[model samples]
Every structure is written in structure tokens, then in C-alpha cells.
Target: MTVVEVLFLLLGLVAAGSALLVVTTRTMVHAALWLVVTLGAVAGIFLLLAAEFVAWVQILIYVGAVVVLLLFALMLTKAPTGPQPDLDARRALPAVAVAGLVLAVLGTTVVAGFHGVELDLDGAVVGSAQTTGATIFQQWVLPFEVLSVLLLAALVGAIVLSRGTGRRGGE
Candidate 1:
């Protein structure tokens, strides 16, 4: 097989495996770590698909910022530094059913959409760093600003919640 195909298969497996671990792992911290893996694999897949802008954003926003925030929250809340409680199969069954339904629908839609469509990306430009930066700054500036504002708000909210014990003195 071609190099691209091999890379795609590897990244796809990593994404899928980490996604499964994210759901299956009992420890919240382990789940977050697995989610980081999943997000990084997704970024790799985006890079392979020639969407460098999306790939970088995936790395910067999800793996870098979001996961860091998650870890911070875990630390602030003093989540068990050890393994989490075992999964309850009864409670998880419903979620599993819903996930299966959604996955089936998505799979059907993708298969139908790509039934006859063949991609020919031989001429498309795999965007450069400068060009991608210019496009985001010039065209997608509003969304970037919005994302930054949202992140700022989340940070402030987490700090507020963590500090609000509501006890003025020793009780």
C-alpha cells in the first residue's frame, strides 16, 4: 500500500482505540489522557487529509488548551489521584445504546454520501503556515476571537467555582 494509506490506517486505529479507552476507562484522568490521544490522532488525520489549518487548531485548542483545563479542574477538585471506581454496566447500557444508534446513522450517511463520489486531490494546495495564518486572521477572525472569549470565560468560571466555599470563617 501507499505511504498515505498506511499513515491513514495507523492514525485511524489510534483515534478509534483512544476513543474507546476514553469511554471504557474508569479513571477520569486516564479518560482525559485517552481523549488527548484521540484528539492528537484526529489532528494527524486532518494533516494527512491536507487540512493543515484544522490540524493545528486541533492540536492547539483541544490537545493543548482544553486538556490542560481539564487537568487543572481535576487538580482543583482533588479528584482521586488513583484509579476511579469501576464502571456500572446497568447505567452504561442506555448510553451505549444511544451511541450505537448515533454511530449507525452517521455511518449510513457517510456511506450514502460517498457512494459514487471519488476524490481527486492531486492539484489542491496543501496550505502553507503563512497562508493558513493569513486566512484565519483575515477571514475567520471573528470565530477565533469568539473562541478566545469562550476560553477566558471558562477559566474565570472555574476559578470562581473553585474559590466559592461560602464560609467566611472557621465554623
Candidate 2:
């Protein structure tokens, strides 16, 4: 109906289509790239919703850090650059069913919760960087630190797995 609604719908379609490609693509690198696109579309949606902080975080954390990490890992591990031959399509039906069910439930909940409700964006400061930073530092510091440590550990693990005992020249 409105321009914002039209833009939101377009972004939603992009996000959904890229997400589907992320899961269905046979190439690992392509899948990771598609995931980046999906995340970027989600960030666009957040920007449309007037959540600037969240949009930038989504771009920085997901599209920048996570996807780059994934691509780095793929390269480090010498993963196949082309389409995989062993990709299984047997689970597609079940996966689609589950995805449809989840989407239906979430759609129902959102419609019921916000039925005919209009958001007043004027003077709203909830998604500002100051507010988000304070909330993260004050309330989510420990979990955030723990997650950082976990990601570091995973990166180290991937490197270790790729290197494999460090023996060279038949030593």
C-alpha cells in the first residue's frame, strides 16, 4: 500500500530467495556468498524499520565477519571451488515442510500480535547506537565475551584441522 511497505516486501523477497539459495546451492563458496546476500537484505530490512544500529551490526558482524570467516575457512581447507557431486536432495521435502510450518506459525503470531497496529517512529530512540551499546555492555557483556571466545576457539580449531599434525617432507 505504501512505499515503505513496497520496499519492505521487496527486501523480504530478496532475503527469502537468497536464503533459499544459501541452502540449496551445491557450491560451498557460493552458498556462503548467498548467505552474505541474505544477511545484507536483512540489514536493509532493519534499516527500513529505522533500526540503524541493528542494520550496521547485521552488515558488520554477519556479512563482514562471519561470511569472511566462512570464505577464509573454505580457502584454508582447500575446499572444492565448484559444485559438489554428493549433495543430497533426499531431505528437501521434509525440510520444506518444516520451513513452511515455521513460517506459518511465525506469520500467524506476528499478524495476531500487531493486528491493525501502527508504529509511531517519530522521536523513537530505541535503535540508536547509544542505546544499543549501553544495553549490550550493561546487560549482555558476559554472553558477548563468551561468544567471542567461542568464535576464536572455533577458528583455531579449523586451522588445526586443516593443518593436520604439521608433518612435512616425510619427517
Candidate 3:
């Protein structure tokens, strides 16, 4: 394999490992931090694929903005810092089953969708900014909107929790 292939494989492994940690961690803060690592690894993989703009977008949008917002929400909510029994329990059997099911579905979809299509990585990308921007927005609109809603939900939850504490303390 080539050097780029090796780097890509390494980054994929890192991303996968951190993603597992993100789901399994008991602490909210640790999970958010692991999510940052996972997203950074994904951005590195994009860089290896010669998608510089996409990689930077991933870093700036996911690693910089989303994770920071998640961390802020966690802090504002004053979530429990101790080990969560519900999160830590039975991590092996159920987690493996769900992960396997997801992998099977995604793998089958990718194979069916791109059965004979070949990716030509050797060609230089020469698209204008408008074209690239439009493509990104078109393809990523769902995910971007979903994340926006999720972040907004977290912010609202934080506000609710903080108010509860304030009223309890008679502030």
C-alpha cells in the first residue's frame, strides 16, 4: 500500500476507536472530548483523500464549533461528574449487536450504491468556489440542520437545568 493509504487506515482506526469511546464513556465531558478526537481523525482522512476544503470545513465546523458547544452545554447543565451506572453497564453484548447491525446496513448500502463506480483520486480538483459551496450545501444540508437542532436542544436543556438550580437555591 502507499503512504497515503497507510495514513488513511491509521486515521480510520483512530476515528473508530474514539467513536467507540464516545458511546461508551460514562462521563458527558469525556464523551464530548472523545467526539472531538473522532471528528479530527475524520478530517485527517478527508485531507488524505485530497479534499482540503472539506477537511478544513470538518475541522472548523465539527471540531471547533460543535464540540465546543457540546462542552458548554455540559458545563451549563451541571451534569453529574461521577461514574454513571446505567451508561457503564453491559457494554459488551448490546453495544456489539447494535454496532454490527449498523455496520451491516451501511456496508450493504455503500456496496449497492457504488457497485461498479470507481473513485479517481489522481485527478486535480478545479471547481470554483461557488460550485464547491453549492455542492457542499446540497449534500450536507440534512446533517447540518440536524446538528443545529441538536445543539439548540442542548442549549435549551442547559437553560432549563440552570433555572431549576436557581429556583431551588432561591436565587
**Top model number, TM-score:** 1
Flag clash pairs in model 3: none
- Which 10-residue span in candidate 3 carries the lowest summed lDDT? 162-171
Best by lDDT: 2
Candidate scoring better on TM-score of 1 and 2: 1
Lowest summed lDDT over 10 consecutive residues: which window, candidate 2? Answer: 162-171
Q: Model 3, range 18-125, lDDT digits (tens) per residue?
A: 999998888878999999999999988887777777788898999999999898888888878776768665557897899799999999999999999966667657
What is candidate 1's local distance difference test score? Answer: 0.88
Rate residue 156 of model 2 by lDDT: 97
**What is the C-alpha lDDT profile of model 1 across 20-128, one tens digit per residue?**
9998888888988999999999999898888888899889999999999899888888888677676447588799899999999999999998988965556677876
- Summarize candidate 2's per-residue lDDT along 19-109 as a digit string, tens digits: 9999888999999999998999999989888899999988999988989989998998899998997775765799889989999999999
Ranking by lDDT: 2, 1, 3
Q: Runs in model 3 with CA error above 4 Å?
A: 88-96, 109-118, 126-171
Score every model by TM-score.
0.80, 0.74, 0.66
- Badly placed stretches (over 4 Å) of model 2 are 137-171
lDDT on C-alpha atoms for all candidate structures = 0.88, 0.89, 0.84
